[model samples]
Target chain A: MSEKHHIIQVWFFVGVLLLVYGFLILASGLAEWSHPPDIVLAELHAPVWWGALMLVLGLIYCIKFLPDRKA
Target chain B: MTAMMAWTVPTTLVHLSAVDLGIIAFYFALVLGIGFYLKRFANTGEDFFLAGREMTAWVAGLAFVSANLGSLELLGWAGSAYQYGILAAHWYWIGAIPAMVFLGIVMMPFYYISKTHSVPGYLQLRYGSATSALSAVTFAIMTILMSGVNMYAMAVVMKVVLGWNINFSIWVSSLTVGIYVASGGLFSAIFNEVLQFFLIWFGALLIPILGLIETGGWKGMVARIQQNFPGQDYTHAWSTLGRFQDNPMGMHWTGIVFGLGAVQAMGYWTTDFLVVQRVLSAKDIRSAKMAPIIGSFFKMAVPLIVILPGLLGLAVLPMHLVPASSLQPGQYSYNEVLPLMLARYCGPGLLGLGITALVAGFMAGMAGNVSAFATVWTYDIYRPFLRKTAPDQHYVSMGRWCTLIGLIVSIGTAYLAMGFASIMDYVQALFGFFIAPLFGTVLLGMLWKRVSRAAGFCGLLAGTLSSVTMFTLMKLDHRWVAIFALSPKAQGLAQDMYQALWACVTCVVVTVLVTLVTKPRPDEELKGLVYALTEVAQEGHTSFLHRPLFWGITALVILAVLQIIFW
Candidate 1:
């Protein structure tokens, strides 16, 4: 693929990632508003779980969109 | 004459035997020596402002932790833990870790790529010069107010614990900091911060380990707390999983978690030049990235050292000693309660000296702020506008002069802060008034591509207005007589949670919606930001997964869950 095409693809992936995380934040807010199951709320609030999820998603997004090794 | 005489009384001790005077003079000489020793490294503007961007990860990391662990946090958290039970740990667990992670992984790359000496510099690149100048001025004002209060708190502790007069303490503390900071610039500030990191950690740890042992160990302390404050909800309160309603003292868990936690976390971790200067001064991107994350490891343990002792103090000390009456009406002064505990419990000799070192630790934190304020004002605001062309030495000299001026202004601010009834209230009010608006602008500038310069500036103004309006309403409504009498239990909790809830909701909603409606910035400027974000992954040597984002989120979730269950 051409360099221009690659840059566009990277932008597309970033857009997706932002959307997904924004959705998660919205979900978390709504979940709190709706007062979800006690177990779910408990899990949702844990820094470990939320931190892990955000990290995993962020890493995957960064790696996929902005690869370390130049082709 | 009585008040004037009261001030001079503390100065009399300065004329005491040569030995006592020597110790004070020795302290001054040592600090100045460090400043002068580091002066060679600060020959340039970059070095003076940012240590020539050569600080190692470990130094940056430790300095970051030390700078944030001010006396206010040490004293405030302890008081909070004493009043609210263990659930107060959520402040560190839920608030600090996630914020640091977000800052490191997501926000920091923008800073690294922009290569801005100040956060406002980044604003200029991404938005426009107008927004940048506005932000620089706003931040300087906020730093002056916040650092002033922090300085005042340290002076207050010295006055209460050592029986020194307040004005004398302020003068001594301010001058000691001014001399080193003005001479050394960021170099001395970072060096002193490293020393203070150890001092604060050692001082904070000494209180709890010694206090617990004195009270018969953790089990004995726990038993005493349970016995005295039965059904006080220690388990839920201490746990990381608890909600806003979980705190018995009625501190709004959500408001603190989000408002102070998320908002102030964004302000301090992302925007504040003081914290950002540490990262910007790093040897490389990897060091900058790793420093705050590693620093957070220390921050995670700070509550154990600082807050736990206050909770332990509740069990060991008398009710009158840690009396609720000491707190001003409609205000919480829990931060003051810790030093009071030290004066009562910790005997003189090495133990007293160690606690005195803790007071120094707090001073070190305030000194770091003074150094940062001077650096930002001198390099970003003053030099840019006033003296556009100058040699590196000239800028460095100006930085030193700015440091002295900054210290004097902050000392005056601290004296004024004394009029406010509660330390935490004054600190929070200042933060909310100034930073809440800036948070919106910076956050939008970083994340949203579509936010225009006009919108960014407008959103900032709107967020500030919203925050001030909410704060005013809360203050006014709090004064009106209640229609019906509520139990003391209900009243306390309501008051604790109210301010945090209003501030968070108002700031977030106003900033986001306003930015969305406003036009986007010119595409050319934003394109660079986009390219930089994409390139950031390639620039840093460390693996992406090793980023603190994963660990931070996990920790935040675990702590939040624990807080909820415990609450």
Candidate 2:
């Protein structure tokens, strides 16, 4: 038999956290890019690309097993 | 964000508004809640100590590096960046990645499948009781002392950044870490550490980003630093590393590669129990192996959080703004870079979040150390010495007790760690004295089954004695380290690295020579302990692309590219 202990096992709390955090960070980046403010968003040199990266990873993680919850 | 109260460390404060205090309070409560909430999973000794052996690679991975990635790391190494420039990246790259990847690729099979609780427990199985006891005692002391150093770092950050009483900050931080760790054990500690890993990124992301933008990005920042520091090229890593005297830091290339990169890095990452215990708490053998691999990836990126701020500070903060205490006759307290950046860049809500990130780092660090101390004290020492056949419940109780004792001892030790020029260097010196010899001993014990119990014990004993003796000699007179460096300034860090390298050599030499003379342990006795004798439990089973070996190789390749690019 093949053996690969994938870390894709169901996570109870962490999964939800990833989903919320990912969505928030990803959305924040998108929002910032789309609607740049004169002053509120000024002085903010935040790494939106990094946030997108975090979001993609987070989405992949959450989407992989979010629907497959175990009792 | 700027409280223009004639800013000075210990006296000057961030003058946190209500929002900042609220965020910090909420963060502390959340951490404690997570700890107490996990008490259900920690009923048994295994659950309490090893998180029921169910740590996912991601969780364990983050916790693995986060254990060391505290304010001490972010603040101390950022200070290194401010003083030494991009060469500080070596600590994260060559100093950590190779050894960490090696642990995942080579050592984890033995560390995981054999099912040892602590590093000393592994030693006991391989080299017998005396060696294990010595390791356990030394490790326990190291963990407590290191935990104390974390405590001191937390206090200093508070005193400098927020202008709090150092003693009050230390006591409060210790109580918070002590409460969670004593209640939930490793489960709480690892969970909190993983949380902290994210928080630190969230908190400190602003400085480097804003600082770079402020200076007109990478090229601009480099130009600024060059202007500020006339002959020093702070942007490059490997180019300046060709010679110690060539660099502003007066460090040699040989010491960087051999002493810091090989011995000190391998010693701490591979052998030290603080980080190892996090990996051991992983869900399974493969996860244990994968944990450090994943940590290795983050470890590569971590310099961004810790080091970038320092570089940013170099290009941004004026020389006069640096505190008089931190600034010497010529040398500036580069240690103030992180605090200075935090104070200058972050505003209101973000400022509180940044402050919490650092506080969380210290808290996580204290928890990591206390948890490690408890495990060694319980598994390696108490179980073997106090009551050999005690109930698992009793051992868990002992672990909790040790957690309290460890935190208390650390408070005392934190007092000792103060006044050092760089917390990073002071910690490196500590690592050299203990970790360098231990790695030498463990390296021989694992790979060569011929290493006898007596040989291991005596080799470790002798190597340790030599490390202390060398330190004493160097402290007493410059004549002791005359061979290593011509001047006292060059002797600063180069001496520690050389001493570690020589001590490691001494341990290896002594262990080898002694093992050759002494009767060897039978192959049967070394059945899962020695590399040659042990069956690779999870080898060739993992998907080649997904396996730790694959990821470890991938990390090394990335590291090489980064080094060359930065060079």
**Which candidate comes out best when scored by DockQ?**
2
Tell me the tens digit of each residue's lDDT in model 2 across B1-567: 133322345455367756567667776787787778766667788888887778778888888999989988988889878877887888899999999998887888888867998899999998888999999998888887888788877877776777776777777778888889988898889878877887798778877877777899899999999888888887888777566667756677777789888898999999999999889988777888889999999999988888888888888877623332366543346666788788776555556767888999999999999998999999999888888997889988898888998898888888777666677767877887899999999888889888999999988988888887877788788887766443355545677888788788888899989988999988888888888998886566657977788899999999999988897
Candidate 1 global TM-score: 0.76
- Per model, kept true contacts as a fraction are 0.00, 0.00
Residue B208 error for model 2, in Å?
0.8
Q: Model 1: residues >4 Å from true position, as ranges? A: A1-71, B1-28, B238-246, B321-333, B344-349, B419-421, B479-519, B527-533, B539-567
**What 10-residue stretch in candidate 1 chain B is worst by lDDT?**
B481-490
Model 2 TM-score, 2 decimals: 0.89
RMSD of 2: 4.7
Per-residue lDDT over B1-567 for candidate 1, one digit per residue giving the tens place of the 0 to 100 score: 234324432322111222223323443555567777666656677777877777767778777777777777776567667766675566576556766776776777778777788888887787776777777887788777777877777765655555466676667667777877776677777777775564455445546755766678767888887788776655455342244344465444445555556675566566777777887877777677777877777777787776687777667765523333455443325555676555543322222333444556656766778777777677668877888898878877887887788777877787666655345556656666656567667776777777677766666666566556656655566542121111122233233233333443454566567667777656666754643334565545646566555555655666566556545
Model 1 alpha-carbon miss at residue B318, Å: 1.8
What TM-score would every model get versus the actual structure? Answer: 0.76, 0.89
lDDT scores in order: 0.61, 0.79
Candidate 1: Cα lDDT at B379: 62
lDDT of 1 at B55: 74
Top-scoring candidate (lDDT): 2
